[model samples]
Target: MTVSSGSPLAPKVVRGAFVRLDEIGIGVVPQVIAFQYNPETLTRKLKPYEQPADKQGTPQDPAARAAPYDPEEEMDVAIAFDAMDDLAEPDRHPQTVISGVADRISALEMLMYPPATPSLLTSAVGALAGALGIGGGADPVPTTTEVPIVLFVWGPGRIVPVKITTFSVEEQAFNSALYPIRAKVTVGIRVLTADYFTSKLTEKGARLTAAESIAATAYRAAVEQKKVLAAVGVASTVESVLATLPF
Candidate 1:
């Protein structure tokens, strides 16, 4: 999206956002949690997967190739929210006057929780039966709680699904109703790789359920896009390097 500036020569400004999908692949794009103001700084770390030290010397199979795995990637960013700006324009942001930044904060936090399921009442009933010494007539249906897939969008080049590993919120001010008026939030996220859907994810012994399988498919699609992007730069990069050579 392009924003009109006083000078036509001004660069385009597109805000970053965290878009929540209905499920994963083929799911509807339902909700968007946009950044009010982009974070000034982002912290990122990558640790490539390598053979263990003990296994390095023990490898004798010449035909076996190196194992492929995605690097462990971590990202941290601080988001600031204030309700004063919205409160100044009450007509457009009437909800802000009532809840301050509470609504926005809730939206971000909800990404970590699974969507409500219809089995909630059934589960409650089973618990009550157990307490009264009455057995449930039949095996209860299992309920799965899967967090919604989220795409962290920083322009078009970097759009990836990530899992929230850490979250911290600091409320600097609150209104009379105890709603936070000004707050700062810090979130630590890890990118989910495509291998996850194929049972190739190597971090833990964890296995994906049917719901997460959908995300794996979408993750693969994103990985393919990244590959194409990298390939496009190869020729130009090689030419630039050759032109700068001393010989």
Candidate 2:
């Protein structure tokens, strides 16, 4: 997801999706109003690993050094929607109001369960058939599988796979039947850290999804690294030297 100089300069439209192990598709696509995220870092000032030298043969400006740090990146998104409240065709999809809300909740619930697999049902049917003396072979027992992680893509320069950490739903209105018609949902997601990719989620080609998150992470790292380098005068020094070079 590198941004090339030739790429478009406009802000990319934000879109989100869920990536599954057995299937490649999104569970729900919400119209998000605002998306917020920040990288939180913890740094400890400790004795310098290698002290700088001066003409006096003593450590120069040696007191404490900030350790190399990686910030924890997390995102919070807000989505507001009104289902049956449309003016043009208020009844267009009367069922949509509640149905849409249901879909959103369903998508969140999926994070806690494994993707729908036929093996579980197949095994049960096979067992029943064998018990009934019908001609059938034993089906292989199914192992537990993990639910898919969601990917939020704001175009190529911003594609990150994330896990839903927390979410809240607030209903503003409801129909006569008490079904929600207007609601705002706030979802908090943590970017799947590189450590996670290298660990548990690596099985079954999940590495591809890990790569996507890594790319998003690289973008943040570049920004933070740039700031650090600029503060240390490295960036300006390099730029000045490069400017004097002949083509």
Candidate 3:
């Protein structure tokens, strides 16, 4: 399904009917936190090690060559992982959660028209965008603005991929210890799905649900470190915006 760009919430809209595919929790190990490496840092450190010019066109001084090079300083980044035990009791079933939300959204879309077209997907996205406070103000919306929405589609045989884009606002906050703009805010919708595999007696491979296909597609995109980081950054930005919004 496709969503329109005109809706206020279109920036954050995630639309689709999803069925439970599979749900399994995997343990996440603690790892060192590394910031995006700055190329300049490496260049600056290496510059000091360059060989001195030979004015006499002869062998350089032994003392100059024997000078010990200073080691490059490493930035210690702080990173912490949440304990799995701290998660909700009974554990939230990822597949069930995705399926329930997708079904609700699909039912809501059905009520919007006598005969639903793919454009209705835009309305569904707009509904979500509005709730998230994206667009829908007196100001004219920018045509070029784009928001990233992730969708997971599951089908009986294969998975389908769809990505929706729209516009959203951006906000920033100060950090006393670091820099003035330490945090940011962005409003958008994030769609996630979990798929289960089912084996058929007649076929050698397993059959997948419609929802599972979509979820698989989203999962593939999310597997990329850059995509995952971007998704998380947007989510964190939206959370900050929500916390400051006046009720």
Give a tens-digit lDDT track for model 2, residues 1-247: 2223444886544443334322222112222222222123222222324445878887756565643433456766665656643423656755464354555555555665765563444555556667765544444233447655555554434445567677788888776667666677666766654555555455765554433454346456544655776788975588888889996
lDDT over C-alpha atoms for residue 88 of model 2: 35
TM-score of each: 0.69, 0.48, 0.17
lDDT of 1 by residue, 1-247 (tens): 3344448888767777777765322224347888877899999898776665455567454454565888877899799999988888989987888899999999999889876652454556556656665554332334348777777777766677788999999999998899999999998999887665566455487676444565676667767787998888886698888999999
Cα deviation in Å at residue 13, candidate 2?
Answer: 4.6
CA-lDDT, candidates in order: 0.74, 0.51, 0.32
Stretches > 4 Å off in candidate 3: 1-106, 109-205, 209-211, 225-247
Per-residue CA lDDT of candidate 3, range 3-81, in tens?
3556887673222222222111111111111111111221111222335558876756545544344222112111111
Query: Against the true structure, candidate 3 has what lDDT?
Result: 0.32
Error of 3 at 188 (Å): 16
Model 3 TM-score, 2 decimals: 0.17
Pick the winner on TM-score between candidates 1 and 2: 1
